[model samples]
Target: MLEQVANGKLTKWLAPSMRVGWSMVETVLLTAAAVGIGLWLRPEDPMTLDADFRWILLVPLVIAMRYGGLVGVWAMLCLIGCWYVLKTSGLYAQQSFPEGAMLGGLVFTLVAGEFSDLWRVRLMRADSAASYSLERLKNLTQRFVLLRLSHDRLEENLLTKPYTVRDALFRLRSLALEESSDTALPAGDDLLGILAEYCQLQRAALYPCRDGVIDDRPVAVLGENRPLEKDNSLLAYAMENQLLAHVQQEKEESYHGAYLVAAPISNSAGKIIGVLVVERMPFLSVNFENLQLLSVLLNFYADVVYAGKDTHLLLERWSALPFQMARELVALGRLREEGKVETSLTLFVADDSEQAGLILDALARGLRSLDLAWWVSDRTLLIMMPMTGVSGLEGYVLRTEQWLQDEFAFMSLRQAGVRFFYRHMDTRSTEVQLAELLEAGGV
Candidate 1:
């Protein structure tokens, strides 16, 4: 079996390389042999056989056609020299060297061979362009097919019940956020039940976490008569790698023969908090998409734990949310109008990357405690200052630009060159104007 596998790989490797080399070799050798035979067939005496053997030139013509003009020129020189030697020795025919025929053959070889080479080059370029276009078309088609399948799945799931991927995620987020008011996660058993139903698993178990290590005892068990062992390698492997594991059942005697999947639940800090073991029900094949969705939901549960059950502080630091920014903007506008405080909002739209993040970090450190910033898009950030005006905004922007230039020499944050866009909101503006500015992203 090993030898067969090795031979198969060797054949695959040789197939493409051998094709061009073998064809060139075969054409060169075949044409040379034909030329030799033609010379031998010529009569010894000039009386019986014709001295003009124009048919012999066919060998060089073919070489010029298959190879190129340069190769044809070289072959012509060799053939002409051989013909001269044969004729002078009276081996070919009783005649002197045919200089006119030789010259004609040389011209023919050069012209025909170069023309063929030029045509072949053009053909190859055209083929390469076509292959590139075909590959792009295939990629587009595959994306379209995947999108169609996703849409169909969404519709089918929604028609069957109100619970869909969106609802499952929203419920998970709500549960995570609820940690602020409570110490122990409320309804841990119910949450496990929700997960089991969402993933359509027949039997499952959930473990509680203490000080980063998952408790061996099951905190919640669903649709199972007896609890499974927590020390299994399948669960241990998933927790160690921080990934979902699907144990393939090889036979009834195998270790994971009864279970289908083992997954870990981790917090934002990547500390394993729980393990979810599930059994595959008949006729229901688990898929990658479902596994990913389950993993995200579990991670959110972990995030809740990491937040120390405090929803407010978690929400404040994670200001990349539009609604959060909008709420703060409304409060700032009201405070400005009431003559209680002076505040400004700056909209920064820069390319999304690690470098842009550095700019954000610098701003975060330099700004006051009341200042706020959030990513409105993958490439845009909105910053709100509780007590800053237009002049203060100008200084902040310039300082940040200087910092960016100093840190990354290749990148200059000049007004014209940089993709970053920023504008300070007018605190004197009316509520309607504030709303308009927020809606239009300061235009």
Candidate 2:
């Protein structure tokens, strides 16, 4: 919705008034172009209107079809009226036609042109409104399906401690891999399962679209039907650039059929998460509404994944965190990638009480942002040190421990096992070190 077109002098001068004001200008310009072309085709004296002028009549027809449906007809009428008035007064002498036939042709042509434009406007509006309504309906259905899946997941949690969404996804990957390892299907994805359940596809195969070729590697059967890898893959380009590619139907082959429709699963802010492909029986095509429905459904699938991650579990607390924190976190992520700065991993622990919450928040405010990660357990809070490795962590640990002993030594947390932990995370997790710290603090 927010687009910045960078070039063109005419574009620049008209940009501010373009959307609303430009439509009328377009109508006028089109009319002028049509009339000018019409005059070229049938140049006549001001006094004459000829039946041979039929070729030029097409000019008005083209204009009416392009813009200003009813308005175009009215303008043409005004042009004819001016001509007739100019001729009748002897200010101009009208040329001969088979006189009555000329009058008859003029009447017939004017009425037909008037209604032709009206008919076009009606058809276009109807087509547009109908398509829009169908699109909205399709989206609603897809969201309904996604919400239903969310509800099913929630229901499972009622009777037992449910896995987090990330765990569920990992489990799904394992299951998919196991099932498809023997079969000619692709592994490590939950997409096909969702597609099978909803769209009732016979079997959906996810093909790797590299460059301009399709690589069909169903279920870890890599290079099964090898398509040449292009220097740049088409799918990758579409994804990185935020665009869509036309669906390609498959010819008779040993591969699963064409992805009848494909869309990039995008986050709420419209970043591509992954691609969703829906395949179906050969020779079948989806209507506009159904296609829109599929689009909405796939997007909803992406939303639910995010919901299961942070939203579903920590709605209240997450909501309470200022939006600024989220923005800063994203900035930290970008900075960390460039590898310019260093950070130290630290932990914050407090009794599960209001006072502890306040201190943890204050600590959050004081800490420098980095491309970092953090975790909050029942009593302990953890922050990731993307800035530093093991060597930098030792001094930070000692100073931080002493600082905590002085800072909150008066509060219940001091006696209540308030502690901090610093662990150097190499290529592996610092889980064991965290456990030792937690145990030492009797947490």
Candidate 3:
């Protein structure tokens, strides 16, 4: 209650008032000084000498400057009137009132007038600086937000979807549609495929050979709807040196066509995952903003390859997750398949009806209810453990055995189907390797 009362008082004390609390304070102090000085300076003509009240004149000026501009003017006029009354009443022996009044007015005009001018300038400067800073902050925020959205879309295309020629072509075609003014020039085979389709490079097969020449071996070439030129040495050179090059630069002179460009793909860890390229003619017309967007999109492409952000969705559809989940059940019924991390997936087919309820009761010991990323395929549950390593797969499998023990005590958990397969992460080995390990242990 006391605090509330104090706040109310503070609200009433808003400054810049002519007859406010501070002005009253100045008035009292000045009046007292004038009275005291009059007696001290000339006691014989005390009223007459102080009648002008030269010192007291400053009180109203100070109040006006600090509070209201119009109040200061009114105060000067009042002081002059007071001096005349003192003189006319014969309280002052002064011959005329104008002399004292003039002195008081001069003092106010010089002191208070100068201060208000200086204060206005200072306030204006401060306001300008604040406005500039706010504008800059807003612009920066806008750029960051745009970049984030671009990254999201990039991950959706690169990491989540299966790499197919037709899929990639669709993306490139979409970009052309968006930038309607750009020429629909023929897209170079490799770069065009990824650009119009996947927002990546078409050069998946080009790699460095033993003799330092670029070789097209080990590339994932789409048959018939080829995305790369067969004998182009320049394309090979660019991919071999990890060089940034245009897909069109390698095109035959007779055709005189170039619409794609590609760079070697790198993962989040900066290791080359594969070559990433884009195909689009009239690309030179793209502005700085658009180019920045492309760079961001490509970086996310690398993330998909290395991070396995959406790999779970595909595996679930296959009814066989990429191995970190349900390791025990998947490990059964396979003799040749190694219970590995990256090379294979371990599936634990969970039953939805009777089997699910039974499994939940049996494995109710320590297994957490909040499983992060999981997939059900062929009635099997596949878990992607990004932290699991090959060595840890066995332990994860053991955990599975315990879960299975609740229902089929004699189901010899080791008799489940466990198969390991290697995913081609192109050149992004470390990230791919790490992903593989994570999927193995469901970490």
- lDDT (CA) per prediction: 0.59, 0.45, 0.43
Q: Write one digit per residue (lDDT tens) for candidate 3, span 150-199.
A: 98976654453335432332243234221121321112243334543333
Candidate 1 residue runs with Cα over 4 Å from true position: 1-41, 45-53, 91-95, 133-443
TM-score of 3: 0.28
Candidate rank order under lDDT: 1, 2, 3
lDDT head-to-head 2 vs 3, winner: 2
| Alpha-carbon shift of residue 283 in model 1 (angstroms) | 10
Q: TM-score per candidate, in order?
A: 0.39, 0.24, 0.28
Write candidate 2's Cα lDDT for 96-119 as tens digits. Answer: 333553344445556654665566
C-alpha RMSD by candidate, in order: 15.7, 23.4, 16.8
**CA shift of 228, model 2, Å:** 70
Highest lDDT: give the candidate number.
1
For model 3, state the Cα shift of residue 386 in Å. 11
Off by over 4 Å in 3: 1-194, 197-237, 247-280, 284-443
Better of 2 and 3 by TM-score: 3
Error of 3 at 223 (Å): 16
How many clashing pairs does model 1 include? 4
Top of the candidates by TM-score: 1
